[model samples]
Target: MGTHQLTTINNSDTFEDSICDLFNHLESTFTYKRFGKNGHNQKGIDVFSTEKDCAIQCKKKDLSRKDLLIKKEIFNDIEKDVNKVINDDLKVKIDKLIFVSTYKDHPEIDEFCEILKEELNTDFEIIYWGWDTLESKFLANKELLNKYWSNFIIKTDSKETHFKRNLDLKKKIAKDFGNWLNDSQANRKLRSRILLRAFDGTQYPDENEPDEFGQYSWFRAEIKSLYHKGMEFIIGIDEIQVFEDYTWDFTSNDNEPKGELVNVAKVGQINFSDIIDYDIDGDEYYMFPHVFCKFIHKGTPFENIYYYNLDKTYEYFEIKDKRK
Candidate 1:
């Protein structure tokens, strides 16, 4: 359900609250309820509401409402999966797939949107409630954003909780970083990119293979640590440079530079353990670099400053194979 007029009050709210509010606002306003056949929910289609008898799959953002950007393209993958499930269930043609978000600039969130437009072979209209989009479309509804400014909680993992607990025990973690980003224009400076990981020794959904649609793709990394011990998830980052005019294909997605921003470069060195507060001297590691392409140029530095998506591909992936 991605074609309805969605109006969100806030980007930040508790998980329970966001889900409840999303259901309530749309259902009450439109006289609709979730459509469940055989008392079953076909995943990804979180809120399937019917407005004027039309079905809408109200997909929520798989995010933490914290200081990180949600991975973008996965939403498109979700749409594919959801559509697959929907089509398999239906005998007649289906309706639209409406993806709702709070922020429009999120890489993972935005990337999938582009894919949706292409995959659906039509306008994958992703609606969001943010200052950037607000001024453009909802200057009249500015009061709504101002009134309900909050964030939704990203579901947590046991391992992530363990890691967080460890960090909490040592008081090594930053407190209220989310609040910091929420408070000012400072968040604009804190950008991140999205990366895919294969922990169970293989990529989930297998991006290189084609689906019934014959497209080799997968959804955004929403539920982290989906597989354990040998599983992995895609991650979003702020340092990767995404070129505006370029597309990321396996065979040379990086661009030939020109104009105001000539090239984009990563800062100092790559250190996986640096992000980990706990020790990792013995823990194994890997490397598979992803170059975030935006309107950036070469020589752009990363350090509380601008960065670039590194262009070169290793003999292997960025998050694996390096152990080097």
Candidate 2:
């Protein structure tokens, strides 16, 4: 597989300029129209591809850093660009709106895009192109990679080949873990061995453990309880904050018991699949299943929160002695 440094492309301004060029190389029929260098007539649109009938906006963010832009900030940027096409006199009949960026994957992007579509009353589809997705596209087409990275010495294998190799390794681990489970008596008793370690150490607790904010140590204690019950490998997930500057009120609404408080750690949109990106607390543990259970407020729709149910029972997976 190609070992060219994509970070160099991420850190340079040329990446934004070359985005349309890269897409053109991918699809032979693609035609890119730049809004202009002066940024006067462009509105919010950056690059328009005639072949796909797509209006593309290229955003190059600091991929090395996380939470650089908040949720509203990202929404606002995309909204303005979409409006420029819909409301402007040009009436650019775009079938698809594509946003290409170098930022890490944001789970809330899909929900936010749907909200925008509903608010605008449009039928256009929204697509987000993050770093990993872009990497996949580059790997699928080496010509596109060579065109962008002039210094890249084309490797013998493609990116798809490299991905398959990694995926195969993960499957082998899962298979081995499954085999160990089938061989063990303890694991065979449990219905599900899913791990729900979402908020182990997200917050700090003080002298008085307030029920409203909840104790940060609660998750740690829960894990201990699970371990005592024969759960060996545990999986936990947390929200990657969308808004950096805003503070959420932890108080519960009038719907619940008077003194009982809602768990504030359970707030925001989280993609459990992204948990693979999280570092394990050393090699003592490994990831098995890649799934998530999202809890959202029924009244407000996309207002999602994550909370660990202390009393909930899941099928337990006893860790093999070797992993310990």
Candidate 3:
């Protein structure tokens, strides 16, 4: 199951509405409603279930924008919301207060909630629901999942055929890009010159070997060939190691380079499943799949060399070095 589906909700209001809808569907006895217009004067309550005397506060935090980690600010916000709900006037007295967040569950957040409950010494029960809980709930309810995250729908006959079609389209795209890369003019323009960022896996040095700076290094390579090996798409390339003094300036047409030629041809496996649809210079829009190349370096297999499809101008491929 894709637990990251909920993270696609780009706004706080939508997230709060989703939480409200989820609880209303899950609990048949309770009927939840949005507390106020645009959550103004809500008294720390975004959703309220009057029938069950329950109050829910939704916290939407985009971890991607916030360095992909839960911080103390979230905990502090939760504490403040809990306090607001406890020490405020409302139409109906709430016996239960629930805090819902788009963030994944963390040990520190769990422990903090426990501490808050103990210190508050309230008669009502306090509950915290993170992304894990939301994901499980959405998985169980097809309608809810489809309503909120349309991308995570279950595969039916038609859906399965659509997925297969997308895969076939990606294969064609890869083949086209491979052909373009092998062209004489394209080869002359990009060979041993295009610098690509390396993939940083979850497990640091174990899964990916970084340079002395504790970060992945950009690599330059020339595509030798592209083919399908079993269920994987493989790219054959001759890796180039650039010198320390080599200045990477794409604006200038300087042909000189200070890099060593690594004549060893390596077969790297590419991932075509992750596709991103974006616009270029606010004009042209296209769907581009990320090319994750895993090749063996110095006898150790390293999953580096990230590539993406750039704009094709007059049968030549232009390298757009933008980190998505």
Q: Please, what is the whole-model Cα lDDT of each candidate in the order they appear?
A: 0.33, 0.49, 0.55
Q: What is the C-alpha RMSD of each candidate to the true structure, in Å?
A: 17.5, 14.1, 12.7
Candidate 1 lDDT, 244-308, residue by residue in tens = 44422221246543322223332222122222221211123212122221111121111122233
> Relative to the unseen true structure, what is the C-alpha lDDT of residue 202 in candidate 3, on a scale of 0 to 100?
40
lDDT of 3 by residue, 1-324 (tens): 321344446687788788788888889754898888573788878888878889888887766433223556678887888888777766667888888877766666777777888899866677788878887787788787778777764544465665775578567655555544456644554432322223423432233345334544333334333433211222343334334443222222356534532222233433333322211111122123223333225322233343222222323222323222
Best by lDDT: 3
**1-324 in candidate 2: lDDT tens per residue?**
444335436533466567777677666645876656544687667777766777778777654332434444677778887787777765566788888777645667767778888888876887777766777667666676667765656556666785665465445434534544445433543333333333322222222232223322222211211111122332233222122223222332544332322222222333322222322221234233322222222311113333332222533221111112
After superposing candidate 2 on the true structure, give the runs of residues whose Cα lies further than 4 Å from its correct spot: 1-5, 8-13, 68-72, 153-324
Could you tell me which residue pairs clash in candidate 3? none
Cα distance off (Å), candidate 1, residue 175: 30
Arranged by lDDT with the best first, the candidates are: 3, 2, 1
Candidate 1 stretches with Cα past 4 Å from truth are 1-29, 36-39, 52-69, 76-82, 90-94, 102-111, 120-324
CA lDDT, candidate 3, residue 136 = 76
The residue ranges of model 3 lying beyond 4 angstroms of the native Cα positions read 1-7, 66-69, 156-324
lDDT of 1: 0.33
Candidate 1 TM-score to native: 0.29
Candidate 3, residue 277: lDDT: 26
